[model samples]
Target: MNIVLFGATGNIGKVILQEALDRGHHVTAIVRDPAKLSVQNPNLKVATGDLLRPASYEASLAGADAAIASVNDPDPDNVPKQAQVLLDTLAKAGVKRFAWVGGAGSLEVAPGVRVIDDPNFPPAWKPSAMGMVKALDVFRASKADIDWTFISPAAHIEPGERTGKYRVGGDQLLVDAQGNSHISQADYAIGLLDRLEKGDAARKRITLAY
Candidate 1:
């Protein structure tokens, strides 16, 4: 498969790029600066471009089997805009399949209560969380024929050893026997790649955790 990946230098994006390459897929990593991407492989190509300006990298999206975006911004307000550009770019480029590295805040903890609505939700993270929620809304409201899949990680995600093992869920948050929701960054990458390869979760949002 040929894949075009955005945010190739981000924490999760880098891992996803590696995961794709290890699977023998040809990956074109789009980044603002090519030097920032340290990975070099026969199957990997780094393209210089900007996410907000899809025209800068529209050629890279064409003829790609799938596109995955792990790009994130500290300012939550900007994420949705980036998502909008991504969708428009992919649509214009004629790439029908896409996978977005989503935020967990939109996942429901109850019938109508989202994880971001919980009182215990960190105040500092609210903006970013809500930003992701808005991004999901943008995707849901889109009328394009793109087979878009959004994968939100566990409540807590950080760098950790990749066990290549984790559980999956939809809409609702996935918790372990101890009621804990978390997953390592490496394993989360594994889950994202699995979703891309299977294409079973298209046009839906799924969560991954322990």
Candidate 2:
């Protein structure tokens, strides 16, 4: 498959790039600076573009079998706008399958309650978390002709081993025996790729954790 990706320099995006290449898929990455993407693979191509301006990378999406975005706006307030731009541009580019690396804040921790609503939710993370929450809302309400899937990572995601062992859930946050919700970046990439290949969660949000 020819896959187009945004935010290829990010922690999660880079991992996704590697995973796609390892599977022998043709990947075209759209980046603000191509130099940041150090991965070298015969299947990988880098395109210089801006996330806020779709025309900058609009051509890259053409003929793409699927488009994945792991973008996080440097400005927390702009996340939703950036997300909308990617969605609209992909629609215009005629890509049918779209996968988004979303946030866990919007996942329900209990009936009618989200993680961001918890009193213990850190203030520092609230802005970005809410931005992702808004992005999810945009995807849900949009009427675009696309098969969109939003995968929310666990509350704690960082550089770690790719055990490729984890669990999946819908809407609700997944937790382990110790009541912890976390997943390694490597495993998260595997989960996202799995969804892209399976096409099981059309127009729905899925959560990953272990």
Candidate 3:
């Protein structure tokens, strides 16, 4: 598959990039600074582009199979703004498939109780989390015929073991026997690739945990 990736230097984005290359898929890593990307692979091509500017990366979208965005702009608030632009750009390119690396905030802890609504939710992360929520709304409300999937990570995601194991759920938070919702960065990327390849969670929001 010819995959176009955004935010290839981020925590989750880097892992996902490696996973895609490991799977033998042709990938184009779109970034502002090509120098920041150190990975060199025959299947990898780095493209210089800005997410908000369609013309910057639209050329790279030609003949693409799908695009995945693990997007985190300098201003987290720009997530929603870029989302619309991204959809428009994809439509113009005739790329109907997209996958977004989503946040846990929007997942329901209980009926009508989102992770962001939890009293224990950190205030420091609210701004970015809310930005993800608005971006999600943009995806949901879009009239374009894009087959998009939003993959939300567990509540506590960080560098840890890959384990190559995980569980999946929709909208609601998934927890283990210990009642903790967590997934390693590696496993989260693994899940995203699995979802993309398997096409099991297309055009919907799904959470990953273990």
Candidate 4:
């Protein structure tokens, strides 16, 4: 498969890039800073472009099988706008499959309560998490030609060893007996790429945790 990825330099994006390359798929990463992507593979191609300027990379999406977006805008106000740009661009490029790295905050902890709204939720993480929640909605409401999938990582994701093993769930948060939600970055990458290859959670939000 030929995959076009946005935000190749981000935390989750880096692992996704490596997983795609390791699986022998052709990858074209669109990023603002190409230097940050240190992975070298014959199948890997890096294209310099900004998500805000979709026209700049329309050519890059041509002939691509799928697009996985991991773009993160620290500014709360810009998250939805950036997500829309990517979706619109992919739609115009005629790509049919789309998957985005999403957030767990939007997942309901209680009937109507969200993680981001929890009083115990960290103040520093609220902006980014809430942004992702909004972005998730944008993807869900899109009526474009693309078949989109939104993959939300576990509540606690960080660099860790990949056991090639993890649990999957839908909508609600995944937690263990100890009441913890976590997943290694490596495993998250594995899960995302696996779904990309199998077309598992088409047009839905699937989450990963312990």
Candidate 5:
């Protein structure tokens, strides 16, 4: 499969890029700074562009089998709009398969309540989390023919070893017996690329955690 990936330089994006390549798929990574990506493979192609300027990268999406977007913004204000632009561009390009990296905060911890709404939720993470929540809604409300998948990571995602194993869940938060939610960045990438390759969780919001 020929995959077009956005945000190839990000923490998660880097792992996703490697996962795609390791799966023997052709990957075209679209990023602002090509130098940030160190992967060198015949199947890997790096393109320079910004997500805000979709027209410049339209060609990158052409003939692509699927697109995995991992774009993020520190400013909560810009995240939703940035996600909208990418979705709209893909729609216009007639790309039918899409997968978005989502936030755990939007996942319901209880009926009519979300993690983001919790009083103890960190103020520093709210903006980015809320942005992902809004982006998930944007994709859900789209009228396009695209088959979108929103993959949300666990509440505690950090650099860790990829055990090449993890559990998958739906809207409810996935927590261990110790009452902690966590997933290795490597395993998260593995899960995301696994879904991308298998087309699992199409038009759905799925999550990965230990």
Candidate 6:
């Protein structure tokens, strides 16, 4: 696969970049500073661009088989706007395969309740979580001629060893025997790549856990 990735230097994005390259897929990463990528492979290509100015990275989508975004906007309120920009630009660029690195807050804890709805969802995280919730809404309601997937990680994700073992679920948060929900960032990248390679969960949100 020839993949074009945004935020390829981020905490999770960099892991995705390495996973894609390790799988022998060609990747063209659009970044403001390519120096931060730090990965060198014959299949890896770098392009200069910024998400703030969609036009700067619009041309990078040419010949891309899939586009993945792992973007972060500190303001939280701007998340949906960011998602919209990606969808609109990718649509115009004729890139149909799209995936967003989503948040776990939107995952349902019950039939009609979300993790963010919990009383202990953490005040600091709600703003960003809500931003992603609205971003997911944008993806769900989007009429773009694109196949989209929103991949959410476990409720608790951080740097950890990659065991390459995990479970996949939709809508609901996955928990283990200890009632814990978490997965290593490296394994999470593997899960995302698996979905892209297998074409799983199109037009829906799938989550990862261990």
| lDDT of every model, 2 decimals | 0.90, 0.91, 0.91, 0.88, 0.88, 0.90
- Deviating ranges (above 4 Å) for candidate 6: none
TM-score of 1: 0.96
TM-score of each: 0.96, 0.97, 0.97, 0.96, 0.95, 0.95
Off by over 4 Å in 5: none
Winner on lDDT (4 vs 6): 6
Candidate 5 pairs with clashing backbones: none
Ranking by lDDT: 2, 3, 6, 1, 4, 5
lDDT of 3 by residue, 49-142 (tens): 9999888998999998888999887688899988888877887788867889999999998999999998888999999999999999998998
Could you tell me the lDDT of residue 4 within candidate 4?
97
lDDT of prediction 4: 0.88
Runs of candidate 1 with Cα error greater than 4 angstroms are none
lDDT of 6 at 6: 91
lDDT of 1 by residue, 1-210 (tens): 899999889988988898899999999999999988888799998899988887789888878989999977877888999888888888777887899999999999999999999999999989988899999999999877688998999999999999989998999999999999999998999999898888889899899999
lDDT measured at residue 34 in model 3 versus the true structure, 0 to 100: 94
Off by over 4 Å in 3: none
Q: Give the per-residue lDDT of model 5 (tens digit) for 1-210.
A: 899999889988988888888889999999898988888899999999888888779988889889998877767777778777877888788887888988899988899899999999999888888888888888788776777889999998999998999899999899999999999999999999888878878889999999
lDDT of 6 by residue, 20-73 (tens): 999999999998898888888999999999786887987778888889999887
After TM-score superposition, the amount by which residue 106's alpha carbon in candidate 6 deviates from its true location, in angstroms, is 0.8
lDDT: worst 10-residue window of model 4? 71-80
Clashing pairs in 4: none
